[model samples]
Target: MSARSLASPQSAGEQKKKLADSLIKKFNKKFNGPLNNPHLSSIIVAEVGKLLQKAKISPGDLEQVEAKISREAVSESSAVLRNEDVRLRKIKAEMSSKGGLPAALLSKEDRKILPKELKKTIASPKKKPAARVSVNMLENTVRARNAQLDKQKAKHTSVFSSLGMVGPATPDSDAGNILVGAKSLPLDQAVDPWSVLIMHDVKKYEDERKQREEQKRLQREQWKRELDDQVKINERKKKEAAMEEVKYAEEEQDQLRVADIQEKKKKEAKMMINTKLKEERAKTVAELQEQKRRQLEEQKEEEKSEVRRMEAEIARAERRQQRKREEEAERAKRLQEENKEQRKMREEERKKKHRMDLEYAASQARMLDDLERRRLEALGKIKEKMKTIEVMGDTLGHSILEKEEEDERRAEMWRQAYEKKQLKVCFFRVCWCRGACNVCVEAVRDRGGEMEKVN
Candidate 1:
């Protein structure tokens, strides 16, 4: 039966009452009929009531059971729908591989209609491709649907214009009038039913598409701004790094230059010190050599003076010995002359004695007296000689004193002469000397007590 016919109020109520009355009449007739068994009928009626009561109880229990079963069935059906959704997606993949229609348009049971629709769409020349009803198509459909909306908007604008307001009517402006008109007219009054449905879906689809497009544009702008900021940051870092490198290089170069200058200065200072030291050492060596030469000359002069003094002493001793020998020879000659005189006198006396005794005796007496006088004279002479010797000794002492004084005067003269000779020699040596010899000469002249001459 048609669902509408079964649900009609008058038919549903009348059918329920007639079924109830028929069941009651069947019970009464069965008891009052030819069977006419009262006890049996009563038992049957009681059994029927009991059966009704049982039936009612059974119905109530069945209703409770059915509700529980229905809840379980509904949960199982939902599970089945979820499983079917998965199966449908898999089938969609297979069908898409075979270039069939999209599976999104069909429910689990309705998917069977998809093949028939695809067949019809492909076989009938009048049938459009499903792609014609896609987002792009829906956009176009929305644009066409807006034509009728535009007419309604124009009508609303006219109503507003009658009130003397400016421009067209807005959505917030009296949609009450449009709502009343929309309610009074059937849904398909102004447009084909299918077209009205399509237009409505198209409008909703276009609005969602616009909102998604705007979101994407905003995201693209945000990404672009981030990229620009990163580029600027990288550029700044590169510049800073390059500057730091340059600064470090400059510092290194400066340090190298300073080191080079210091090295050069050190070398110069060392060279100057060495040169000064060498010059001072040479001067000291020259002075030492000059001093040694002067000392050697003094030593030679001292040796010569010692030799001269020794020779003078030896000559003075030899002269003293020769003077003593001459004195002794003179004394021996005087004694020999005296001895010859005395012997001649004695021989003459003997000859006189023999010639005349008496006469001779008187003569002899006179001669004896003369002889005695001569002897006395000789003794006085001897005494006078002794006195002369004493006088000579005194004279010799005076001579020795005179000689010593002369020697002292001579020695002083020699010393003065020797010093003069030394001065002359030193002058000559100085005039002839070369190089540093002038300094040696100056020193010698100072030592010789001739500094005034040098000045």
Candidate 2:
């Protein structure tokens, strides 16, 4: 068994087996097995080489070992050839001691050394020689038989004898001479052996028939005498039988008349019984027909009632469907109205919010304008008051009293402007340094814009 077959258990039976094995098997049958996969073979060879390295074996050593084996094989083959030559010489020497050279090649001097056994075998007659003698003897026996047959039936021989028991032989012919003769049949002609056997049997039958006919002719004459006596005895028996037949005919005639009368009575009784049975059968059929008619009428009534019930149910269902349709329409209309009202309210709320935003924006713009107006008006009034004080001081060149009055007037104006407009510029200018902080920068920018506006 192969490795695959040995590994399989008997009970497991047939299996396509491992996935890889099945794939490889199909691949090999389709491709050319391992030979077609050169890369795979190369990888396997490489792995094998690595494995052999563990045993300290290399490809070079493998080549040298193979070469040494080949050399030894050549030497052994040469020795074998030398031994074979010696063996052939010994065989020839034995043959020379036992017998001379074969007769085909023997010389006059070598012929005397021939073994006695071989000489006897060469001289004796074989199967072919003996068979030739037997054939000749058979031909002589056939000739003698043909002569006897001709003497018995010489006048009977004709052209048609070939198809008859004698087989076309004349008085001067030998047995089988027609079958073997060159002129008798075409060369290589096929003949059925059965035809020859049948002809021989027919000849034997003709002779047997002749003897049986002679014997039967004597028996026929003897049988005719016995038959004449038997006829007289049969005539006496016929006369007695004719008397008995007359008496039997009369008794049969009486019995036939009685049987005919009884048959007529039995026929009448059968006719009466058939009439009664027919009447019962007719009555039963009529009752069955009436019952079937009643069942059909009842079925028809039930069908009519069911049809009416179904029509009423359909009407009610239509009414319910119409009501449901109306209800759905009403609900849809109401929902449409609700959705419209909600949209209207949302639009009004959006308009109100827009108005509020516009109002707030206008109020902010008005407040900014008012603040700008107050600052400009206050700055202009302060400038006017300061110019009046400078002019009054120029007119009263040496008047201290007048200078004191101007200072009091300037303080009064500052107080009044601060109270009326909440102006803090004068106080800021008195306390602030130039660009000292956020307050000073914002005050300077505001004051510069106010002064420009006033100017």
Candidate 3:
């Protein structure tokens, strides 16, 4: 029996070797684990082995049970380990990628319980909120926005303030917090965010705004300049038109004045010509009247001269007729005286002849005377007586008687002769005187009658 029992201990050693091999295979198959740190794998395998030993089963049973529990534990541990390994690698990767802990890693408990060193390793640093604006910069922006809003609001204060409600406050107070409390307000009463932003960024926004405003102002100024220039041009044109009208009026007036002057000159010329013609006509009439007067005066003078010549001729004719009449009367007287002288001489001759004859006869008769003687006695006685007587008577008677007779006879003869001669002479003288005187008287009468007729 001693020999046999010693042989049985060898057989038990072989069975333990088999059980260990089966457990390793089950563990490997159940858990598909990754290759990890060798030290952790070794510690886990040793702990599994000690639990198996504590159960004190047979080597075969222990192998089976150990394999089952090891398989289960290894399967669950593989998932947990893989999860834990992946978490640790992510933590390390996060720490390496950002050079610090992820913000999500901090927990409420970790925040409360972490030591300073771990907190330093796990906590992420925070960036400060944007720095609060400077008081002066905020004041300046607010002032600028207020001033711009005021300018925009000038037309209607209520409407402009409503529209500009989002704008910054004035520089005097509360410039930065002006829009901070506006969110809880009603929609109508709220400040606009866009408007606030615009107000905050006023310097940049207003620069572009000011440029546009300047452009608009420049455009308005240019338009005003153009309008003013047009107005000036219109005024100038109106002035020129007015001046032209005045000039035309003045020219018309000048023309009228010239025409009037010309008409006046023409009238004056006509009047002068008419006056001259009238004066000439009057002068001609005066000359004609003066010529007629001179002609009349000359005719009168001629008539007067003719009358004086005729009167002188008539006086001379009268004187010549008177002288002829005186001469004819003297001739007639001389003829009568010559005829009377001749007659007286003839008468004396005849008487002397008769006496001579008587004386002769008486002488022859003386013888006869004796017879007468007887008678003579008587006679003688007578004779003696006679003688004596005769002587005485003779002486006385004879002388007386003879003387008486002779005287008578002689006286008669003388008377007869004288008477005859006187008668003849007287008759002749009368006849001549009658004829001549009649002719002369008739001529004188006719001449006187003619003179009376002429007168």
List per-candidate RMSD values in Å. Answer: 83.8, 77.3, 99.9
Q: Candidate 1 — what's its lDDT? A: 0.45
lDDT scores of the candidates, listed in order: 0.45, 0.44, 0.43
Clashing pairs in 2: 161-168, 162-168
How displaced is residue 90 in candidate 3, in Å? Answer: 86
Lowest-sum lDDT 10-residue window in model 2: 125-134
Candidate 2's displacement at residue 168, Å, is: 99
Top lDDT: which candidate number?
1
| TM-scores for candidates 1 onward, in order | 0.27, 0.18, 0.23
Q: Across residues 279-307, which tens digit of lDDT does each residue of candidate 3 receive?
A: 86697689669967985896687568657
Which wins on lDDT, candidate 2 or candidate 3? 2
In candidate 1, stretches whose alpha carbon ends up further than 4 angstroms from where it belongs are 1-195, 312-455
Who wins the TM-score comparison? 1
lDDT by residue (tens digit), candidate 2, 105-205: 33322222233332332233122211011223345555665566556565664332332333544555443354443333321253433446556655765
